[model samples]
Target: MGFLTKNKFTLYGVAAILLWSCLVALLRDVSELFSPIGGAAAMYTVSAVFLILVMGLPKLKGFSKRYLVIGTLLFVFYEVCLALSIGMANNRHQAMEMAVINYLWPTLTILLTIIVGRKKVSLWVYPSMFVAFLGVAWCIAGDAGISVNTLANNFADNPATYLMALAAAFIWAIYCVVTQKLSNGKNAITLFFTVTAVSLWIQFAISNEAALTFSINSSITLLLAGVVVGSGYALWNQAIIGGNLMLLGTLSYFTPVFSTVISALYLSVSLSVSFYQGVVLVTLGSLVCYFVTRDKPQKYNVKVTT
Candidate 1:
């Protein structure tokens, strides 16, 4: 109990990292099986149920209006952008491409943190970020590598899905940084999950999405994805509030690599060497950004603030 209590926050962060690594594959599976918008709605519903059972409903009485409103909006919007980007993909290969695009948050978050802290960043930081963006181009271009024709053609093929993924990366970076400020030592993740679930259902209803059909595989994927989605958020909330943010933030960039491995096998997308190169660049650049501010611990001082 003593050791567990002392390191619980760090453990939570680690667990969230591992669970989220599986999310891209699971998210793609559930989206394909359940029908994009409807599938996302169902996945969130299952996540809400899982959270309610695990943590019960969050107490709303003390949550600040700013945190309650803004936090909910950012989280829900980010979730929608992420889910829809994958769901709207013209194909599973595009879904994997979108996942790579979403992994840019680690660099974005670290950059935002350095700015928020008003600290002097290493000169290499900007170049690292540039390299990371280049990686998105590389990953998107596949074996074509990074070039005007290939990059433009690839992204143009599915402009909306690519755009949404780009938006998701930015939105999540803001959420990771701002959530600490607004949370007031309170974790509203449970409440946010509930709201996201409800909002998605509404979107699913109003849309022209096909009717959802039941499948044993779909049901099983939904259950697993729900647990991953629910527990990942809950644990991430705890980690941000009290865990080692620097470590977790650095580790977060691994999403692309893990997403590549998991989504490739799960979705049966045979990737090229160039795609793996992009994953490396994305992860490497983000990791460099994290170290750029290593001299300033408070730059990553992401603990809950009132």
Candidate 2:
């Protein structure tokens, strides 16, 4: 019990991963009942309402409007792209494929920090990034039945799906960079409200379908998604701030693993051998990149500011 309390951050990180792992399956289910935009809009709306209840009104005094706008836009972009990537998939397996590809954001975040943020990194980190890309490629190839030609054809045919996944990665990387720079501690809830409003408006503009249908299961799933987004993020923020950053970063590599496994089990999707191989490779490569490049006693100093 003493050890558990001391290592609570580890538990928090794992709990966050579990919540996030449920996303692919839950979103896929919700997408069956609602349009992509509608699902995302509903989820964000619920999350916003939940946060409002928990955090009260945001204290926005002296907050930078520019930061608020930028943060809201970045979050909105990520949510839309993520929704489309999963919602547009033909099956849970395809959604998992998209997720594996989108999981590259963590690696991209590291590279961006070194390249654009001008942080110095070890030479070994570059090769580790390459290995992570190979893992993604392997995952894609496995999804294509281990045929290079089929892989090419798949990309050629469903370019938008793959592109959206890649875009999610890049956009998230940029968002992390921007968030690090802006680090506004007090306006997180306000920014979340802004993002939720924008997402809802976008859904209304694009989707002609009803925001929700009258189904108990769908309502439960949507509410669960909202809880995950709202509470999961709050827990993650606490972990990042209070926990050992290096250890937390290392554990984060398990997110995609958890996501893939939960998605496969919940969706009853068969996993190919190569998929397992790819997962191992990606997980290993991410750990290598993190451990090699990670500074000791790493601190985000962002303060849960959205």
Candidate 3:
């Protein structure tokens, strides 16, 4: 955390934000063409393949067996839930609920840290939690033009969409907790590949109806989303190795911002003032929680290279 307080760390963080924004923008466009399940299946399958190719070489050392096993299991749940949520969403607007809900991970991680690791949390943590929840309430109340009537119709017709979002949020929270405990320098890269591979198999097993079709454009997006973004997640571990937790956490608030922007620009989804306000409040509240807390070094001993 101390290392991350420097000028260089801020620059790298800005670069990460830009990279993530571009990735979300691309996903917003390609999602229209491919079936969510199909695109997700393709994305993770390609991700697994990419991980194997990158990590299978003899020069790279492998992860600890125990850490690899646990990481793979948690990641399996996370990816499956995420893909299902994306698949279930009718459009980008509905799909974004996943992002909004998933950001709860930071708060969840803090709570889980207290519960599982018996860590002492700062005083501001609980208030931050309430602020985050208030953001959710605001979003739910806002006039994004989505309605309870529409949601009811969707629930009656396709319970999968909403159910998937809930499942994704829960699983991702679990993944964050597990990562916080097990992540360390040498094992990080190996665990990244193992998790991606395991998640691919889990998704495959759940969705047995497999037919393959590809277009030049869709295929490229699949690669970028799966390979690039999936690997980008691994890179994120590197980012945190010496980066400011407060700044890092705050910058991640940009994911939803990017999601909202791409949805508006490319997907032609209108941005409601209420929705933006809700997002802004949620993001600001999270920042307040992060910056106001007393400084602590990352508890886990993690190191990364490339």
Give all candidate RMSDs, comma-separated: 3.1, 2.9, 4.9
| Order of the predicted models by TM-score, top scorer first | 1, 2, 3
Better of 1 and 2 by lDDT: 1
Residue 254, model 3: lDDT of 56
Q: What does candidate 2's lDDT look like per residue over 167-216, in tens digits?
A: 88888888877876775553474456457656666766776766456588
lDDT, model 3: 0.57
For all candidates, the clash counts are: 0, 0, 2
**Estimated TM-score per prediction?**
0.90, 0.88, 0.76
Off-target runs (Cα >4 Å) in candidate 2 are 1-10, 143-148, 184-190, 208-211, 298-306
Task: Tell me how far the alpha carbon of residue 59 in candidate 1 is from the true structure, in angstroms, after superposition.
Answer: 1.1
Per-residue lDDT tens digits for candidate 1, residues 30-115, read 88887888998899899999998888888898799898998999889988998999988998888888888888987888788888
CA lDDT of each prediction against the hidden true structure: 0.82, 0.73, 0.57
Mind giving the per-residue lDDT tens digits that candidate 3 earns over 135-177?
7556555664456674466456546756655665556566666
Off by over 4 Å in 3: 1-13, 21-31, 51-62, 117-123, 144-158, 187-210, 241-246, 292-294, 297-306
Please give the range of 10 consecutive residues that has the lowest summed lDDT in model 3: 297-306
- Tell me model 2's lDDT, rounded to 2 decimals: 0.73
